[model samples]
Target: MTTSLSAAELANLVTAVPGVRGIEPGIGSTLRAIGSRIRQQDPRQARFGVVVEAGSHRAVIEIGIDGSRPVKEIVRDVQETIIRALSEAGEHDDASETRQDSDSSGVGNRNTPQVTVRVQSLL
Candidate 1:
């Protein structure tokens, strides 16, 4: 069996990363919500800027960040931390829970769930 991450769970994961001030609303999400409304569905709130796309057994996380930290470094750190969390969940038979190490770029480490981080603002 595989573990699935909820939007709230993902949000918590992102916020826990060091230097991450907060998750901003993704630019495209607003447009998507408007489009969905046209289809007669209630407008859904953006996933705290953390868009999660789940595949057969993994998830792709896209996050928007607002903070006064180095953009590249913060992004990489977030990716690594998220990947680690997912990996841990995959391991524990309890089927629950949740970084970036220097040796690896932490981009596509386990190739399980891919992460993309966008810097929206500084401080």
Candidate 2:
């Protein structure tokens, strides 16, 4: 069985990375936040800048960097951090109840979401 991943949880993890500034707010996220407020939901919980596509097991993350590290290094760290967190969440477990081997890039089995990190700005 596949476990559901929460974008808010993932956002928290990403933001905790040393060189990460915060999630970059895009138009979609902004609109979602507004809609969530209208619906009386916490916009912060509703509109974390991470987008998870569960069907395809993919996550697109936009973040701002502190500019204290190389962009490539920071981006790679974000991807690895996300993959690691998902793996620990049992998101990469196979149908046979076995853990799959993560590749060098930290991508696990089909159940694991492929993480894409985009740096939107330098803080």
Candidate 3:
């Protein structure tokens, strides 16, 4: 489930996520990191792998984060990191914290930005 995302973007996501440790930055920062490096022919997880699903406007990339990390924390980190990456990549949703109504679009099919996280492992 490697991706076409950028390395710098992936590293930043992993570094910014709270509770993420021993996150081999050289390997990848987030699911996108696992994806990016694999895209370039990384063989670290040649057999054991990530599985992903996506929609036209969003994606659900899965990874095997170890057990110690709380699911809540992982979810928050993923959301935050995705938002940060999207913002950095210029994918603006124009969601202003002060203008809730005008920013609902940032949440989804309604035009807002949003992310959904799922923990598929602790191995």
Candidate 4:
């Protein structure tokens, strides 16, 4: 039988993703709360926002960065990291989660049920 993830577990997963830099301690709690109200999207992180949508099995993610590194690179890194960490966590019990840019130019990623990262004037 498969097991679902708790909010804390989810946050742990997020922090583990590569290029994620750091996740707020409340990542799991915020997602859990926003997941109910936001319906399609939620946001997190301080400097760089990392957005995620997670269902029982699958999840989608996007990372927003201000400068320094290209947004495409950041998104790719987030996608790879999230996929790797979550897959390893559950042994690929869930379908392969898809990661893509939400907007053109591939700078921003999509907002999802699980998480959304907004860069409030990136540092």
TM-score of each: 0.59, 0.68, 0.43, 0.39
The per-prediction CA RMSD against the true structure, in angstroms, equals 7.4, 5.0, 8.4, 10.0
What is the lDDT of every predicted structure here? 0.58, 0.72, 0.43, 0.41
lDDT of candidate 3 over 1-123, digit per residue (tens) = 123343334434654565544233222225554564569744322212221222223434344465567767776777677655654443332332344454345434333234444444555
Following a full C-alpha superposition, what root-mean-square deviation does model 1 have from the true structure? 7.4
Model 1 regions lying over 4 Å from their true place:
1-3, 31-46, 56-68, 92-111
Residue-level lDDT of model 4, residues 35-122, one tens digit each, is: 6555643333111223333433344332334456665565555555555555455545434564344243422312212223333233
Q: Rank by TM-score, highest first.
A: 2, 1, 3, 4
Give the clash count for each candidate.
Answer: 2, 0, 9, 7
lDDT of 1 by residue, 16-116 (tens): 87778777655654455455457764322225465544443343344555555667878888888777776665556333332234376535555366666
Which lDDT tens digits does candidate 2 get at residues 1-120? 124456788898999988999999776666766776689964334455776655576677889999999898999999989877776666344444654454534434466558888788
lDDT of 4: 0.41
3 or 4, greater by TM-score: 3
Clashes of 2: 0
